[model samples]
Target: MAAILAAGAGLHPARNAAAAPMPRVAAAGWAGAQTLLALGVVPLALPEIARYRALVAEPPLPESVQELGLRSEPNLELLTALAPHLIVADAGSVTSPLARIAPVATFAPLRPGRRPAEAAREATLALAARLGRDAEAQSLIAAHEARLAGAAERLSGDRGGPLCLVSDAFGNRALVFGGNSLYQDVLDRVGLRNAFTGATSAWGHATVGLDQLAALDPTTRLVLLTSRVPDARTFLALRPLWRTLPFLREERVTVLADILFYGGLPSADRFARLLAERLAPGNAARG
Candidate 1:
């Protein structure tokens, strides 16, 4: 609990006109796959199914969905065989050949200046329209908005300090989420502030050395994204300046599970809920 109560807590149910045949969709990356599921449409195929499971683990891809090899270079022959009605991909995620196989629609989950969650909402509606799942999309969107709002209210007590969302990137350096990242947006929605304010890449993070981490306010809390680094705690301990981080010494560090940091509504919803659920008063909690 972020407090004395449980934090507030998906896809599908609303449907398109019964006369229309359900579209057979193939999604290229995690974001498109998530949107399809949320809109009550299952992808016929997606690349990197295993990696998507290991990295994003949510909104669950159905067992019927075929795996299409690497996301960067999906097996074109197999995709052609699937013969999906439509292929949804991240903009510029794959090469031109993907378009040659089937009609391709590109989605950008993260956009400059706009909140990812908001962007996700618009994308969901748009995708729903394309998939003839408009009714389901409205239901999903309404539910998502409510869940996030409830999570925000649950953490109104200010149980802990502002958080530094980060993951290890070898040596003493870290890949930090701050400034305009999707994590930053979720943190804001959940009533938490991001520790780093400097500008970051369009994807919303920067790789900085231990010197930058050392410069954070002493009271800033640390929330390590550990799904990518199961031994993150141990690895951090090995850093020369690890013991010097004030939050670590004070036990104000927390660990969070996997999140598609650059993903869309599904990831935004996951982050908001997980943060409120995992972050409670005191220290060293794991979400």
Candidate 2:
């Protein structure tokens, strides 16, 4: 079936959505942390605060949050010292070593046969139910839906063509998100289509060479979510083979701001607004 034909965008999810200081919650990963923040709960401690500002870049992290060191290896000692009442992590191991410190909560990244947005909605609601914030979570989800609806309306007209969500390009290869990714769901929500129709892993992305991208329809535009990937435009500018891409020659590429590819609804919202602003008619300038 065509991706546009399959397109549709769901949860019981929560708390009173406040940024209060009590109950001292700590954030672990991008998605879960974002979920909590959307519920108006500011994490007492979050890893890589500086990097998150650049990557996640939305629902801004407060200065009150203590740095938890590396994202992969959160400073257990500091996190323990923080003595949080709850630890919310991304869809990683819920029974992680942090479980010993306090009750842990998490959100799953993917649910079989479920739309990414639906899974996100369910996970947010489930997590909120744990925190006794169902009402607040509902409000948050409603607001997010309203924003997405506005974006869809803004992009109701043709965007000229489909888009390809990708990360940095290197050595003739690039990370491309597939139909099951959060990016794909957001694209679908905004009435946009994904151009990369290839197999992907459980995480919904694959590393394919530039040769694969060079073969895409000439109308496919690129949206680079350069998280950890280095400056691709500069690198590709110096690579002779990069010139072979028709999208580049025709200037159909649209490099987006950094985003946590695996983040929750907030990430999707940021992307939705960006796409609407960039791809809407009479809006062809790049940032």
Q: What is the TM-score of each predicted model, taking all chains together? A: 0.88, 0.87
**Which residue runs does candidate 2 get wrong by more than 4 Å?**
1-22, 93-95, 227-235
State each candidate's clash count. Answer: 0, 5
- What do the candidate models score in CA lDDT, each in turn? 0.74, 0.74
Q: What is the per-residue lDDT of model 2 for residues 64-169, given as tens digits with 9 covering 90 to 100?
A: 8889987788888998898887777776544468777876766664666777787778777777766667787899889988999999988887557678888666
Where does the lowest 10-residue lDDT sum fall in candidate 1? 1-10
Candidate 1 global CA lDDT score = 0.74
Q: Please give the lDDT score at residue 193 for candidate 1.
A: 84
RMSD of every prediction: 7.7, 6.6
lDDT of 1 by residue, 1-287 (tens): 11111111111222534656775678988888887877777898888898888878888878999989888888889989988767888745854687777666666767777766676667676677666677888898788779889887777776566788886557777889887788887777777888888778888889987788889877898888767555446645666567677877776777777888766888888888877776734422542
By summed lDDT, the worst window of 10 consecutive residues in model 2 runs over 3-12
Pairs of colliding residues, candidate 1: none
